[model samples]
Target: MLSWVDGRPAELLSVRDRGLAYGDGLFETVAVRGGRPALLERHLARLAEGCARLGLPYDATVLRDELLAFSRQLGEGVAKLILTRGDGLRGYAPPQPAVVRRLLLGGARPAYPAEHAEQGVRLFPCATRLAEQPLLAGLKHLNRLEQVLARSEWQDDEHAEGLMQDASGRVIEGVFSNLFLLKGGVLLTPDLSRCGVAGVMRAELLAQADALGVPCEVRDIDLAELLSADEVFLCNSLYGVWPVRRLQGRDWPVGPLTRKLQAIARDLLDC
Candidate 1:
């Protein structure tokens, strides 16, 4: 494992760090290959937006250069950048002239079953419902208890991912990936404006769908609509894309649109 703290090789953090105490931080999980990071610009862009939304100080240009250099040195794997508001005194009040900390860590890339992408994976409809917080919606912040609970509901290799929903029973996304459905040949992904993480790969696929002359929509998706869909898929930065072959006790053959988008995602990711 490779780790760097504030641009220096170190492993220490004050217990009073706001990120630890109150989940006050933002993180970016990047995929690296051949000594290069994939969708780096997009990840940085989202991180900067998260920092702004959370009122945290960040320098995109400096961070970009630092991460680029770090990714090159780390080579192939996963690089996670955790930016926190540094250590603080007691209470929820943020301190003055906060000293932001950047912790760069690396891990081995995940190796999933090859059939997960080639043939489609099963989905477990999670019982955990996400609470709507427009302020934190779509931002990859430190808080993730909802996903943690949802993920805990299943523990078998048969299901590669679990689907999450909002309090109103509207399907939001997968526990770790974004969700998309195909109905009558049109592409539809849940609107993340209210809940769920706004995935970088989902954004890429939406663009690709448009370029392919396929109709795409971003709105609410109910359980019935999801179950009735012609095809379904999940996406994230690392896995690229995975079709959902089974959900709600029903099975679906990996449809043409899913294959087309999978091909598009592979081309975009150069994987």
Candidate 2:
């Protein structure tokens, strides 16, 4: 694996980096295949939005070009890009003339079970509940303590991912993937306007589902509603879409809508 910092090749990080001091940054995990980064524009757009929300200046065009050049060299893998507010003294105050740092790291494509796509995978109901933060909601920021805590609840790979809910018991999303439920021919995804990351893959499928004449909605979904859905699936840029056959105790057959969307994602993402 290779790493880059601020357009320069490096491996060290200053202890005073705001991203480390106070989680003052945002990141994007992109799926790379055959010298191409999938859904790159969407990833860049989200990262730019996150930077803006966090009062960090960023250039999406420049970052996109950098990613393209880097992905070409890596060929096939995952590219993790972290944009941080550079070195600052020991305090919470924002630094003047922010020295933004862009850290890019490359890793091999993760090998997930093939059956996760064909049949489905099981999901564990997490005990860790997401705290509601409207201001930081939907942005993939550097703070990921909730995910870290939820993920630490389990140690087995039998459950590929864990389902998490908000303090109000609304099923928000998986640890890393976005949640979607098919019910009565309509698609329902959690309204991440108040929490959770509005992932790039989720946005793509929501738009593409409309083009396919599929009815889709973005709203709050509770555990009961999720359990009662016709079909369930989790998605991200890396894995594309994994049909969720089991969550808690509820089981669902990978429905026709999921199959159709999975086919579309596979073709587009090379998943």
Candidate 3:
């Protein structure tokens, strides 16, 4: 596994980096196949949006080139790009004329269980709730303690992913993925206006659904609503899509819609 700091091979990060000090950074986890990054445009789009929201100085063109080169070097695996506000002094105020730091790490592609996609996965109902923070709601920022804790809640193999919710008890998403549900032949996803990461795979599905003339909605979803759904699935850039079949004693069949979207996602991930 190779790591790059500021676009060069290195393993050390500045101790004064604000990403370590105050979680002032953003990141993207991209899948690479055949020496090419998968869904690169969507990943870059999200990174650009995150940079704009965080006021972090970034050049997408330069980063894109670096990403391509890095993926080429990696050949096939996952590339994690961490963009930080760079080094700072001994206080909370950001340094004047901040220099952004780009950290990229390469790792082996995850080997998720075949049944996770073929049959389905069970969701652990996480007790950890996401706090409402409209400012950082949709950005995949460095602050991920909530997800870290939620993921830590479950330690068994039976649950493949944990379901998270907002403080208001509204269904938010999975700890590591976005959630989707089909109700009355309509596709619905939780709105990220208040919390949760707006994942690239989630965005791709929304667009794909629209192109296929499937009605879609992004709005607040409660546990009751989610439990009543006709079909459910989880998605992320890494593993494509997994049909969610069990959660909190309830079970769902791996339906036709889940399979359809799964195929679309497989194509997108080139898996």
Q: Which prediction has the highest lDDT against the true structure?
A: 3
Model 1 weakest 10-residue run by lDDT: 262-271
The TM-score measured for candidate 2 stands at 0.98
Superior candidate under lDDT, 1 versus 2:
2
In order of TM-score, best first, we have: 3, 2, 1
lDDT (CA) per prediction: 0.90, 0.90, 0.94
Record all residue pairs in model 2 with backbone atoms less than 3 Å apart, i.e. clashing. Answer: none
Model 1, range 68-167, lDDT digits (tens) per residue? Answer: 8888888888889999989999898988877888999988899989999999999998999999999999999999899999999999889999999999
Instruction: Report residue 3 deviation for candidate 1 (angstroms).
Output: 0.6
Total backbone collisions, model 3: 0
TM-score for each predicted model, relative to the true structure: 0.97, 0.98, 0.99
Error of 1 at 235 (Å): 0.4
* Candidate 1 Cα misplacement greater than 4 A, ranges: none
Best-to-worst order by lDDT is 3, 2, 1
Model 1 TM-score relative to the real fold: 0.97
The list of candidate 2 runs beyond 4 A from truth reads none
Model 3 spans with C-alpha error above 4 angstroms: none
